[model samples]
Target: MKGFLEDANYSIGLLDEGATLADIIDNCIYEHTHTGKRAFYVGDLGKLVKKNTQWQNVMAPIKPFYPVKCNSTPGVLEILGTLGIGFACSNKSEMVLVQDLGISPENIIYTSPCKQASQIKYAAKTGINIMTCDSDIELKKIARSHPNAKLLLHIATEDITADEEMNMKFGTTLKNCRHLMECAKEFGIQIVGVKFHISSTCKDLQTYIHAISDARCVFDMAEEFGFKMNILDIGGGFTGSELQLEEVNHVIRPLLDVYFPKESGVNVIAEPGCYYVSSAFTLAVNIIAKKTECDKLLPSGVEQARDDEPVFTYYINDGVYGSFASKLSEKLNTTPEVHKKYKEDEPLFTSSLWGPSCDELDQIVENCLLPELSVGDWLIFANMGSGTLGEQSTFNDYQRPLIYYMMSFSDWDEMQDAGIASDTLMKNFFFVPSCIQLGSEDRFSTAA
Candidate 1:
C-alpha cells in the first residue's frame, strides 16, 4: 500500500568513474527539464538506509523512528518502510500517510505534545496508543479521549543553546515533570516512558547528558509510583555528520547502558527527522535572470562612488517560498555550486542568488563567490532533502519543483535481490520518453 510518484520515471545506468554529484545533477537537468523545475534523486534514499544501518550498529538496542514531518516524500517513506524503520508522526494526516504505507499502528508514535481534541480522538480511533504530552491540559485531553494510551512525558532541557531551540515551544521543565506525571496518574493513564529534545541542530552534547539524567530522575519517580517505565524516547536533534553522531554516541551509549540497562527491559528509540533525509536530497536550481551592479558616481566633489566594484545578482527558479524555505524557517545557509566543471584559469566573482519570486525576502545567498554563470546554467545545493520541500509554498504563481528519484543500477539490483522493493516500485522504473534512458533494452525489460 505504498504511494508511487505518478508522473515520474527512472532509468538504470553505470555512473561514470569519478563523476561528482554535480555531474549527476547536470545529466538529470539536461535530460529532464521541460519547464525548469528542481530534481530529487530517489537513489539518495540509499544513503539514508546506510545511515540507519550505521545508527543501529553504533547504538544497538536503540531503534530509530523517523519523524514524518521532516521530509514526507512518499518515496522516502516507502524506502524507510522497506528498511523496517518506524515513523514518528505529528498529526492525523501524517499518521494516515504512514498507515497507508502499510506500517502497523504499533510502529508509529504520535510525537506531538500539543494535540487538538480531534487529533487525540483520531489517534484513539486508529488504535495509535503511544503518544507524548508535556502539559497538564494535554494530559487531561488525552485522559478524556484516550486513557488507554501509553504516554511519554516530554521533559524540557535547560539552557539549550542550539541553532533551533525546540524547548522554547514544546517540552516541560524538569521541575514541572512531576506535576504532569502526577496529573497523568490521577487520570489513571499509563505512563510508559519519558522523552526530550535538547534542540534541533544541537551543538552541545552536554545538553543530551543533562537531558538523559533528567529522564533518569523521572524514571526513578515513575518507579516510586509503581509504574514500570519501559520506554526512553530520546527525541531527535541529530545532524547527519558521522563525527558529530559518533561524539553523541560516545556520551549516549554509556548513559543508556548505565541508566536504562538492557536487563532493565527499556525500549530506547529516537524520532530522527533531518538525520535520515537531509543528505539524501540535492536541489538543482536554474538561473533565470542576472544583473551586474557597478558603482555609480554623482556630480561635484561629493564622490558618490570611489571604486567600481562588480557584484552579480543571479535569480534562480527556486527560492525561499519554494524549495529553499529552510533558508527562512531553519536559518539554513546552503552553499551553491555551479554545475559545470571550471578550468584552472576560470574566473570567479562575488555574487548573490535569489529566488523567482517578486518579494524582496526571496533571497537565497547574499555575498558569496561563485564561478560566473549564465541565465540558463544550473546551480545545485546538497543536503537539501529535509526541511525544504515539505514547507514549500506556491506563492506568486511559481509552481513547486518536480522531484526526480534516482538510484544507481547496482543499488536497484541490490534492492531487488534483497526483496525490499515492491512490484509497484519495480514497475515504475522507466525512462521518460523525452529524457536520456541509459542501459540496454534488457535492463528495462520490466518497464512495459
Candidate 2:
C-alpha cells in the first residue's frame, strides 16, 4: 500500500504539472495494484469554471442556475458552488443535497413542474418558495399546501431540431397560461415569472426567439391581472459547445434587448445542466478481456478466419447498467479512443466493445475500427461529466468506478492562498479524496 501511495503521488504530481491524460493513466496503472475499472479526472472541473466565466461574459444580464440532476458528482457540485452559481433542484432530496452544501434557500429554484404534496410542504418549510408549475391541478395543489409560494409557469416550446424534445413531458401552452395565471390569482398564489425549455440538445436558435416572444404575450397578460412578473426562467437547452452557445447568444441577446430589455426591470435566469459539466469530465475504462471471431471454427468443419477482414470483441468492466446509463437515457453515442497510438501502417481490425455484464444489451460500441488491442489496454472517453456519474448503480453488486478529485495547480494554489482548508472542502462538497492527497502521506499516516 505504501508503494502504491508513492506511485499515486508521482502520477498526481505529473497531472499537476499538466501531463497528458494518457500519460497519467499509464502511470496510475503502473503504480496501483488495485487500480479501479474506471477513473474520473476531477481536474477538468477547471473547464467548467472557464465555461461559466465565458457564459457570464456572453450573457452578462442572464444568470445561470445549474440543474443538479444533470451530474450530481460531489466534486462537480463543489466546484460549481465555489463559483457562486445558483442551483435548480427538481425534488425534495435534490433540494436537501444543495442545502447541505451550505447553499441558501434563496439560491435554489425548484424547477420541477410536478410535485407530490409532501414535497411541496417540505419546500415551504425549508423556505424554498420559488417553484414552477405547468397545470391548473399543480397550481391548486400549491395553493392548498403553500399558498405563499412564488411560481414560474413552465411553458413548453417545441424545437423540431432538438435531439430531445421536453415538450412531450412538461410545459404549459400560451393559450392555457392566462387560465393558470387566473387560477393562481383565485388561490392567492403569486405568479412571479414564465419559464420554458426548448429541450436538451436544442439546435434551433429560433426556438428561443419564439419562446421569448410567447413569454412576452404571457407577461402582458400578467400585467392585466395586476401581477408584477419580474422573472423569466429560460429553461436549459445549452449544449456547452462554444459555437452553438455563441450562435444562441447572438440571436437571443438582440431579441431580449427588444422584448425584455434591462430597463424593463426583469431578471433573466437559465437552468443549465449539461452546459456546465458536460466537457468537464473524462472516463477511463480498461479492457479486461478480448476475443477474435476469426479464431473460431464453423460447424461445417471450416475455420472462421478471413484474410481480408478481422473482427474482434473487447470487454470492459463498466457497462450500460452503470456509467453508460446515459447512452440509453440521453441517446448519447460514446466513442472511445485508445490511450496509446500505433503507427499509420499498423494493421487495424473491425471491433465491437461490450461491457462485462452478462446482459447482451450492454454493448458499448459496434463496428468500429481499432488497432489490435490486448487485455489491460486503456480506453478514454471525453465529454462524460453530464448525466453520467450520478446515475451509476451497484447492479449485480459490481462496484462503481472510483473518482479522483483534482484541480489545476494554479487553482489549488489560489485556494490555499485564500485560506481554504482542503479537508473542509473535500468533506463538505466532494465524496472523493483529492488526487493530491490520495497517494500522499496525509492519506496513509496515522497521525499528523
What lDDT would candidate 1 get against the real structure?
Answer: 0.74
Off by over 4 Å in 1: 1-23, 32-43, 162-167, 295-307, 413-419, 422-424, 430-448
lDDT by residue (143-163, candidate 2, tens digit) is: 998877999999888675444
lDDT of 1 by residue, 92-166 (tens): 988998898789999999988679889989999999999998888989999999979999998887645655554
Worst 10 residues of 2 by lDDT: 1-10
Global lDDT of each candidate = 0.74, 0.73
Query: Candidate 2 versus the native: TM-score?
Result: 0.86
For candidate 1, the TM-score is 0.87
- Give lDDT for model 2: 0.73
TM-score of each: 0.87, 0.86
Find the 10 residues in a row with the least total lDDT in model 1.
Answer: 439-448
